[model samples]
Target chain A: GAGVSQSPSNKVTEKGKDVELRCDPISGHTALYWYRQSLGQGLEFLIYFQGNSAPDKSGLPSDRFSAERTGGSVSTLTIQRTQQEDSAVYLCASSNAGGSTQQYFGPGTRLTVT
Target chain B: EDKVVQSPLSLVVHEGDTVTLNCSYEVTNFRSLLWYKQEKKAPTFLFMLTSSGIEKKSGRLSSILDKKELFSILNITATQTGDSAIYLCAVLFSNTGKLIFGQGTTLQVKP
Candidate 1:
């Protein structure tokens, strides 16, 4: 089976622009997650979706960060007014359930905000 | 606030040497701890520890968790050049599915 996958492996955008990153979770996975890794920093949790509903969005940094999942399979993370500090690798992961199983990761989308 | 910390931000070792990576965390309702090896964009899962004082082993890698101490250690025995990569430690709490990750430890195993 195909593992978790994300689109736009690399993206470079000017600051103040908006960017939408897409993610396709594994088949039959009910839980999806979004995280970002900044330069010289660890992975930071952004948001999590259980089915089509988002139950835990506390990790979102600010109002510019928002994520939505459709049909409980695909998700999109939108960053509004991207800032230079937003440059990082956005990773997507999925699991069978909320937090009981091991989550599989995707190759990630590296966003460079210039 | 929940936080995870790893020691020895970077390490250099030769092949056949043994290395130990440490992770300590502070979180509410801690459920389990996980270890991952990241060489590229994707991070591969290594182990998940839920019980304290129990060691999980696979190949040359082994990890043990200490709930009382709020820390865990990942030991790689007979390390090879292929072992060079960034090791990440994350803690999963009972509240949500979000994982709190530590600043990874970069290991360099020279041949």
Candidate 2:
């Protein structure tokens, strides 16, 4: 893909329901990252994947938040038993390398937990 | 803990006016600072400052980093209504490949 792409641009779910958001990173990019933006808040780091290495899950806010990247190309963010506070824009980005490399972001999925 | 702070949480400016947004950070092993522009959805990358005192320019936008001061500034000269958006600052830590973002400065440009 020319840029990072996300699925289901918008999602509305009832509290306690599980929701999955997907991201397809650009071809050949080795680094993928997920971030959450709450209402009037900054981007919060969620997780990152690099090749087949153990993902850096230090940013996952709670046990209910989980993510996985397969084949280093696509990634999914899952929230179990979602809460109203989970309503926010979930963003995904990928970089050719990492650190100082520029990250390309996808059109985020706006999740509205009711 | 790593942290990034942006000033002037929100600003309202008239078209043709100049504005400056500030971002300061405290992090371990800082590698680079990035500037992004956010409208309704995605945040588009603008500039990445790696070295100190070097200015990066794009059209009416310019940014400079002061590593010694642990801060960076984004400046817009002769702004337009199209420039109305939230400006975000993020710092990338060395070896970690993680980004810590500031709360962002919301700029509202009126014609």
Candidate 3:
């Protein structure tokens, strides 16, 4: 079984630039989540999608951050206007339909806002 | 405001020594507690505790949760150098299914 996968392993962008990070969940995982880990800090929840339900955006820091899951398998997290504080490793994780299951994580995408 | 906290933000120990990491949380509708080990970009799931007093064990690692006190403890017996990594604790909310994580504990094991 293929694990979760993320794209653009590392990205260096100038401040104010918009960046989109992609995540491909496991073949049948119905619950997907996005998290951000700043340097020397814990992972901060970003967003979550479960099946066809409305996505949970409470964890998103601001309007500049948004995410969408298409076809229930892939998700994209967009940071509209990047700031130096936005520089962090963005991690994607997925689990079975039941949220109680342990999530499988992917090799995160490191975004560096210059 | 729901939050999770880990004690001894950083620890140093020699191989073969036993160590215990602590996690205390204040969250509403707590469903389960999880433990993860991160040596790199990806974090590997270690344990998920849902019941109080029941210990989950794997190899040299074990964890116990206390719902009464709203805390959990992860213990490693006869630690190895490979155990040097960041240990993260997270609490899952039953209502939203989102995990609130603690600022992980960094462990350094010397050979």
Candidate 3 lDDT, tens digit per residue, B1-111? 999999989999999999999999999899999999999999999999999999999999999999999999999999999999999999988977588889999999999
TM-score of each model, paired residue for residue: 0.98, 0.98, 0.99
* Off by more than 4 A, model 3: none
- What lDDT does each candidate get? 0.94, 0.94, 0.93
**Which 10 successive residues of model 1 chain B have the least lDDT summed?**
B91-100
Residue A85, model 2: lDDT of 92
User: What tens-digit string does per-residue lDDT give for candidate 1 at B8-97?
Assistant: 899999999999999999999899999999999888999999999999999999999999999999999999999999999999988778
Summing lDDT over every window of 10 consecutive residues in candidate 3 chain B, give the lowest-scoring window. Answer: B92-101
Model 3 vs. true fold: TM: 0.99
Docking class of 3: medium
Q: Candidate 2's residue-wise lDDT over A1-114, tens digit each?
A: 388899989999999999999999999999999999999999999998988889999999999999999877899999999999999999999998876598989999999999
Tell me the tens digit of each residue's lDDT in model 1 across A1-114.
899999999999999999999999999999999999998788999999987554588889999999999878899999999999999999999999998988899999999999
Q: Which ten residues in a row have the lowest lDDT in candidate 2 chain B?
A: B91-100
